[model samples]
Target: MNGYHILLVEDDSMIGDLLQKMLVREGYQVTWEKDGENVLDIIHQIDLVIMDIMLPGEDGYQVTKKIKNAGLNIPIIFLSARNDIDSKLQGLTIGEDYMIKPFDPRELLLRMKKMLENQYGTFTQIKHVFIDAEHKKVFHRSLHQEVAFTAIERKIFFYLYENRDRTLTKEHFFDYLWQLEDRNPNIVNVHIKKIREKIHDHTGEIIQNIYGEGYRLNTHMKK
Candidate 1:
């Protein structure tokens, strides 16, 4: 919950600055963008967007439409000077929460908090054994257990856990394990084998291979 990234797209410099200050004071990582054009570029990095209805180049409605068309599910809140029903309806039609201008900064912050809460709620840390990404320490119900993991083994484990139910391709593994640099697919297979052995020794559950696709943590198969 530390430093949740927020993208604020406001044409007014003063309002955007104030919003950034308020969010930063509340311990949020704020990325303020004044134009609507560059919004899509940074959309992936932010958890949510605080958008103004009237923006330069493209209006908020058009921006929101494009975002939805692109299949991005990030929550958006519309802050605009237009307080008419039509404006509110338009914003809501495009899947945005509309708030009038001259609103209190604290209240705006609260609205943003509410939207985020409704979307992601409060995430509870999973209480299970996991190899710590940074320290490489194995954690089992708050107890630190010693476990050795090679660089590639750690990468593969983290990738699989990050994408739990989804089947990852060998290309995806190669990209993450070896970056954009070329590497043999056998390297991915070797790392997968090693990871399976370690996880099996500890938990006795196999990371299932999907024949042609890749691997998955088979939650249906109990440890």
Candidate 2:
């Protein structure tokens, strides 16, 4: 598997730099974003985002909410100094994984790695083939059905079907699509929404949301 692309959104330069370095040393591509204003613009470039709840302007909660509402399936890990239950719950409500600040950088990396691994793993053998990268297409032999997919929809399906039964982080998807470059999360959201629609149209089973982690492909054969 390829290394993950990470978005480190922290206002504190020291913390951000430390995390960035750690992630880099671990062989993952890291993009450090200190400003909240530009976060939305580049949300699509990374596989996952390590966000600080206390940002300069918009803050992490608001950012997370926007990402989810936009239909992006990228996983967010909240790294904040606030350890209160309410804060944690709020972060979770917005579909982000939470981590308290003054935390070990190594631990953060481990959590991120685990989260990505869970979402994007390995593929299973099913008779579906000929996926349209721009349009989601799934051909099932048993059902004798063929479905069309949107661009983003196709990417998600291709990623999942290629790595079925595994956890895939938003970071992983971004890396696959944009490599290690920095971009916007909104781009990811656009693709995820399209992909979800295509999946529901054909399979009828909603792509499993790992909750604060990312998305997963349910390999259980549908009847």
Candidate 3:
């Protein structure tokens, strides 16, 4: 919910700024692009793209076509002023979705959510025992306990959840905590212990150590 990254490509300054602000207000991390040329630079980092049909350098169709051809598979929804059948067909055929200009902002948000849900697993479905990335909080229903994380703790849990597919070494956590070359890797152990305590995971260590391999989250993404 909070961490979904969206790419907004619109040439017009006014429209682009407005759309970016709206998307941000809705909790999406919006990356604004003024031209189609810059799409490639941020495409790999974004979850979705909301583009204008008429771009300055390269048109929306051309940019989307290139993205699809590249097999990047990032879903794109065209937000254009061109209200023509041919335009709709071409954009839909080349991209994942399309939406006309002068449309409701709420509807745009809903479509973005749908595209994201279809692409990645739903946020609610992927919850850990007490880790809720969507709401950016932690809670346990059975124990009737809910505790919030500090900024650093939240980052640690989020990173662990995202990379739960494999064991995460202490070095991986050290890199996230500080840019300082002198930061000690032992700090990872301290924080990991704190996270375990806060979540009341005393009996079962959900994020268990993998012996020589560091650590891994013993949780699976719910289908």
What clash count goes with each model?
Answer: 0, 23, 0
Decreasing TM-score order of the candidates: 3, 1, 2
Question: RMSD to the native, candidate 1?
Answer: 13.3
- The true-versus-predicted C-alpha distance at residue 19 of model 3, in Å, is 0.7
Per residue, candidate 1 scores C-alpha lDDT tens digits across 103-207 of: 988787787878876765543222234444444444332222334677667767778766766788888887776777777867777777776665543442446
Q: Which residue runs of candidate 3 sit more than 4 Å off their true CA positions?
A: 124-223
Better of 1 and 2 by lDDT: 1
**Over the full model, what C-alpha lDDT does candidate 2 score relative to the true structure?**
0.69
* Model 3 lDDT per residue over 84-114, tens place: 9999999899888888889998898888888
Number of the top-ranking candidate, with TM-score as the measure: 3
Better of 2 and 3 by TM-score: 3
Give the candidate number with the greatest lDDT: 3
Q: How high is each candidate's TM-score?
A: 0.56, 0.54, 0.59
In order, what lDDT does every prediction score?
Answer: 0.72, 0.69, 0.76
Over 74-147, each residue of candidate 2 has an lDDT whose tens digit, in order, gives 88899888988998898887855888878877787778878876664322323233233333356432112345
lDDT of 1 at 11: 80
TM-score of model 1 vs. true structure = 0.56
Give the candidate order by descending lDDT.
Answer: 3, 1, 2
